[model samples]
Target chain A: MNEKIRHLREQMKRLNLEGMIVSNPISIRYLTNIQAEGTLLITRKENIFITYAMYMEDVNSTLTINDEVIVVDIKNISKDEFENFFLFCENVGFEEGYVTYAEYKKIYQRYKVNNLVETEGIVEKQRIIKDNIEIENIKKACEITDNCFSHLLTFIKKDMTEKQVANEIERYFKENEADGLAFETVVAFGENSSKPHWIPSDRKINSGEPILIDMGCKYNGYCSDMTRTIFLGCILEEYKPYYDAVLKNEILSLDQIKDGVVVKKATEIIDENLKRNNINLIHALGHGVGMEIHEAPIIHTNVESYFKENMVIAIEPAVYFPSNYGIRIEDTVVVTKNGCIPLTKSDKNYIVI
Target chain B: MNEKIRHLREQMKRLNLEGMIVSNPISIRYLTNIQAEGTLLITRKENIFITYAMYMEDVNSTLTINDEVIVVDIKNISKDEFENFFLFCENVGFEEGYVTYAEYKKIYQRYKVNNLVETEGIVEKQRIIKDNIEIENIKKACEITDNCFSHLLTFIKKDMTEKQVANEIERYFKENEADGLAFETVVAFGENSSKPHWIPSDRKINSGEPILIDMGCKYNGYCSDMTRTIFLGCILEEYKPYYDAVLKNEILSLDQIKDGVVVKKATEIIDENLKRNNINLIHALGHGVGMEIHEAPIIHTNVESYFKENMVIAIEPAVYFPSNYGIRIEDTVVVTKNGCIPLTKSDKNYIVI
Candidate 1:
């Protein structure tokens, strides 16, 4: 069996689960490398992936005999066949965080399992720590992201719309060896930077205005996210303190992120620092980055978890003035035993074009 | 109150639901034009939108006094304040399809409601029929999509990579007034067209090969989806029959689509027609299109429902041969009393680029 599925089975055994139904497509891809829309059944003796007829060809092409995953077409299976897949298992686990209430009820009725219990995101927790392959993919994606930022610094000019800049970033990523964007690229100009999750608009960029770009790209199914707020022509005198404070907190947060450090404590320190500057950290300090842009180990005042080695995360610190402008500095990093190493190594010094 | 929320309240009254928690972002956007990550509570006497601090500005900006949606910051609200939002409510409905099992339990515990029942996609059901504004947005999106296709015909050349073509389509959409892609643009060349949901790759286009481009764009908030299978240089003799059969069924299916027509019968006829040509309809005939690319009134053999007037949907007829090429002709149309008028009026005739 593959390492991921074996690790999952070990966790299932510890939870006393003899069977499990993995429905989330991301989880399925993580476990079996099958990127089809399907439900994966880990029974007592068999590991089966049930997909639609349309995806059968793709699924088979992705699978090898060594993977030991049986691909089943949903159309070829009968109601009895479906129910019998997990008939003998005493306890079957499901992703409580992913499966909807209606789907949970349907699975219970259709599979006829004795006890359907909550797995409580077992697969997601396993994904929090990046394997070597995942880390390499993320590193490559981060490299491409840094290159894109460098290209944008030269390409961005006055009168360019936010949408135009966003499109160019997407085009750059696709043209490079990257597999498109990790998420929708956010390119906010001037006052539009005040919105943390601002969608790119057609607003034209002007001289002496803040340009916030939060973008990422995917490389081999892994994601990398980085945000940078730069100035056009020159930085305004009033925005310097806010920019310095955000950059300082961003670096401080990264410095505190290491294996064995409490996530909540690190986030709290950044929050206290920002508070002293009369600013507030509205969002989480950072989040685990992997196949999905956002994953577990959310760095916040509420989450009381310790950072672990091999955990890839994005550390972002920002101060937003409502209806004005915002300054944010972010980096994707890999947690180490004593400290963290930044993957997105773009210069955070006050940059002007 | 807005017309959408008013209609929702009417539905709530019929269902005997005194309160409802709308957690789905799309549903919230549909009911009240506030595009933020928040929970909208429809209480007995108020429409409240609860969001985090970061999104407060955007949500408030999107809201008007006429919207009557009171924006609440989640940070300012305590545990007791949250529970009291649904106080005195006998039955509070939640979207069973959208809310996960874990979230459903959390909502039940946090709200302290008398009964948390399933709303059974009330908002989605209401969204099936397009309002005048929604139809106009969809039509505008479709117009942009048709323009993008016309541009691709002139721009696509031999030796251009699939990814390059896909990126150009995205750039075209963004350069125009369209709001990015409705979904990821699929640009398949040669045998890559065999897969229905093929992601664009670096594979170069060659002469005398099939090129399938399934793409869409979003204008305002509405989406447009279209698929055309054209020849790169020339059509092979073996592929002509399959292409003709798909196009024939595509027209036949659209001709039968009208207000009061049974959706299942329409799909069944298409399926029978394809089977007569020794081909099987692998996927759904089409689906409703509006704010989301895929919405209600799924045109499939299992769905037993009547096509209602003003319902915007995509009618796609496709046939795929394994390890070979496939042909799919699709269009977005508006169902009227007499027949359906296509919004995406791209030519279905075979064109050799």
Candidate 2:
């Protein structure tokens, strides 16, 4: 049996749960090496995997499972899959706020589940504290990202359309052996940069305006996220003040990041700096980065969570002047006991393109 | 003023729906120029959208919607965005099976939604029959796919990993200005071709095996789905019967297809021929191809629907022989009153790679 399955059993025991159902794909991947696409139900006595036709092959080919872990395909099974599941579990701890009425109806009609508690953060809380294997993969993903950036920079000159630059980045991503782009590559230029999460358009890059390139790459299944902002032509003296504030704030927030640091507190620091500059940082200060580009330990104003060792995150704070200009600097990092180490090796110097 | 939104409004009025909540992004995009990264609620009275930060900017910039279409930032709106959505909607006809319990709580709680109806084929029923603009883009996407195939064939001669071939297709997709590969380009050679959805492995291609290349391109937001199986070097004479049967079935099905033709009925003919060869088809006969590759009007056994006029679909019937080889011939076609018009003009011939 995998250690994760045993660890989860302990969690179930502590919560007074007879069983727990794991449906979220990421959580399933985390618990079992079963790359099989499906849900895994962990009971006090037995652990079961519900799958379609495809995931069966994946489990057989890749995963190492204990004999006790049962595998059932919904196709070959009866409607009793849900009924049988509930019958087995008495005091069940489910994912908090993750189930639907439709799902509830099927289960409710099937079994008399008395103890259904919403235990949302248990697995995610564990995930935020990464093992050594996760850190190595994430670091490798970052290295791939950096290499892609280095190759892409040589091609991103003045007058390149946002789409063209995006194309180049994607091209380099594959050539450099990335699984794929972690997310849609954002290559906003000039005034367009004002819109955070702007899709790469065909707008031409012009002198005197800043260009923002936010991109990431997926290595294996783990993802790396990075964003860099640079201005074209001469670096404007007036822009530097706002840019410096953003940079100093990003570095300062990252500096505060360490194991046991509260996420809300980190946001307060960024908020205080942004307040000093009379800017509203509408987004969260930072967010955990891992298999999914955005994951657990969301560092914001209200999240009741703290950082932990081996947890990777992207600390990005931006000052946007809507329809005018915007500046943001971001990096991938891991929380250490003392502080954090930058996973992204891309240079963050303010420069002219 | 877009026609799709107008059409949806008519649907809402007929359903006595005060409003319709669209959770599928592609469906939202089909109706409104606005693609919902999160969800879009459309009432007979008004339209609203809730999406993440990234796509909201793009849609807001491009779409011209009525003032009342409230676009909410889902990340900021609720405790958990998916659960929050259920809370936001009232008396809504959800895209029933599409939404999970994780997504229904908030809107479901907020609304007196006893009138919750399962909208079986709302967007898909509409999307199955595309308009002029959609057809033009799908045609263009197919052309791009065809050209990439022709170009790659000119250069590929052996001694390349499956990854390299996949990369080459991606490069050609970019070089010819495709949005991106519609899905990860599948390049399987020899025995790897046996698995229908084989992810490109690092294995080198060997001679004397049937090669399968299933690829597509997304031009604009519309996509093209296609699959082409080719024989490398010379093949045994016995294999020709299977190849002929596959091609004959595709041609016969294309001839028999017309508006109002039962989808599975089309597959029944192929299934009968497949039985003659003692082969069981693993997947559905075909699927409606549109903005999304696998849309609606699934052509398979137990499908209780029929193809309608203007409905575009990819009719692919494959025969899989484990550990040896397989043959699949696919093409995109438009359902019409008389019979069918083949949209993807790429001829499936015995290409000796």
Candidate 3:
């Protein structure tokens, strides 16, 4: 059996689950390395993948016996055959966080399980600790993102629209051979930067205005996330404090990230430091990133999790002045024993392009 | 009140639902023009949108009082305020297809409703009939897609990897001012075209082989999907029958599309025609395309739906020969009273690049 599936089987046993239906694409990729449309059924005896006939050729060519997974076309298998796979299993696990209620009911009827148990995000918990290959892919994705940012610095002009710059960032990622964007590229100009989740619009760029960009890309199925806010021509004197506060807290929180440190402590430091300057850290401090852009172990005031070694995450600190401007500094990092290593090598110093 | 919401109110009355909680982002965009991260609640007296503080500014600037929707920051309001919106309601409806089981439990507790009922895809049913503005946006998206297809024929070469061509397709859309892709662009080379939903790989395009490209993009939130299969050099004589079957059925289906026709009949026609040549119409004939690339009134053999006037859909007819080659011809169209007008103007004829 593949090591990841074997480890998952152990976790399932601990939860008193005889079998599991893994539906999340990320989890399926983590276990079998098959990135296609399908459902993975980990029966008591074997791992079976049910997919449409159209994908059978691709899945067969990509996976093998060493992966310890059998691929079956859904058309060739009867509903009775699917049910028979779990006839002896008393309890089956399902991804409660991802499956719809309607799908949940369908799984129940199709498998005819006695009890369907929630895995309680067991797969997500397993995904937090990145393996070597995962780390390498994430680091490469970050490298491409940093290169894109550097390219943007040279590409942005005063007359260009915010949407144009955003489009160029996406264009850069694809041309440079990174899989499409990790998320929609956020390119906000001037007062539009006040909203942390602003989408790029057709507002033309102007001198002495702020430009905030949050962008990332996926490489080999791993994701990278980074954000940088820069000025077009000059920085406003009145916005100095807000800008400095965001930068200082973003650096402070980065230094404090390490194994065994509570995730909220980083958020607390940002909140307390920003509060002293009459500002607020309104959003999450960070979140885990992997196959999915946003994964487990969210860094926030309400979350009670601690950082672990080899865990990949992004930390973003910001202060927004509604309808005026906002400053944010973000970086993707890999947690270490003493501290975290920043994967995004983009310079964080204030820049006026 | 907006007409769509008022129309939904009538559906709600028939379903015995005094209140409805809509969490699907597409559904939220369908009712309100605002497309940010939020949840929409339809109560007896008013419509409420609850979003994070980060999105409050954007939402406020986009939505107006005439839209009859009140925007509230989730932080300033307690769980009690959310419950109060639906306080007097006897029964509440929820989207069964979109909401997960875990989210269903959270909504159940948050609202404290007496009865939580399934809306039975009521919003999706309404979305099938395109409004004038929606049709215009979809037409524009299709126009952009057709232009991209024209560009691809001249840009594609024998040495380019599948991923490279796919990336160029996405770049073209963004550069042309389309709002990203409707779905991931599928670019297959040689035998890779046998898989209907093949992800672009590093396989280099070879001469005298098939290349299949399925791509789409959104314009103003409406989507357009199109597919075309062509030869890198010359078409293989053995693959000629498979190609002709797909193209013939595609055109035949387009001619039969009109108001009040059963959707399954189209699928049956494709299936019967292909079976005579020992080919299969392995997938759905097509699906409705609007705010979503794949929406209501799925054109499949099992679906019992009738064509509606002004409904935008894509008819994709395909034939796959395992480990060999495949051909598919698809076009997005608007159903009219007499027939259907092609929204996607890409040529369906075989091309030798």
Best by lDDT, which number? 1
Cand. 1 Cα-lDDT: 0.92
- Clash pairs, candidate 3, are none
Taking the tens digit of each residue's C-alpha lDDT, what string does model 3 give over A1-353?
98888889998999999999999988899998898789999999989999987678779988978898999998888888978988899999999999998898899888888889889898999999999999999999999999999999999998999888987888799878787789988999999999888888889999999999999999998999999999988998987888888888778877888999988776787688889988877878889999988888899877778889999999898888888898888999999988889999999888999
Candidate 1: tens digits of C-alpha lDDT, residues A1-353 = 89899999999999999999999989999998998788999999989999988778879999888789999989898999989988888999999899998898899889988999999899999999999999999999999999999999999999999988998898899889898899989999999998888888879999999999999999989999999999999999999999999998888877888899888888888899999999888888889999999999888999888999999999999989878999888999999997789999999999999
DockQ values per model? 0.85, 0.35, 0.71
Report the lDDT tens digits of candidate 2 across residue range B236-286: 676688888888888888887887777767778778888887668898878
Q: What is the lDDT of every predicted structure here?
A: 0.92, 0.78, 0.89
Winner on lDDT (1 vs 2): 1
Ranking by TM-score: 1, 3, 2
Where model 2 places Cα greater than 4 Å from the true spot, the runs are A52-54, A65-68, A73-82, A93-117, A206-209, A231-234, A351-353, B1-3, B9-16, B36-39, B48-91, B112-114
- Judge candidate 2 at residue B201 and give its lDDT: 82
**Residue B112 CA displacement from its true place in model 3, Å:** 2.0
Whichever of 1 and 2 has more TM-score, that candidate is 1
Best by the DockQ measure: 1
Weakest 10 consecutive residues, lDDT, candidate 2 chain B? B81-90
Q: Quote the positional error of residue A277 for candidate 3 in Å.
A: 4.2
Candidate 3, DockQ to 2 decimals? 0.71
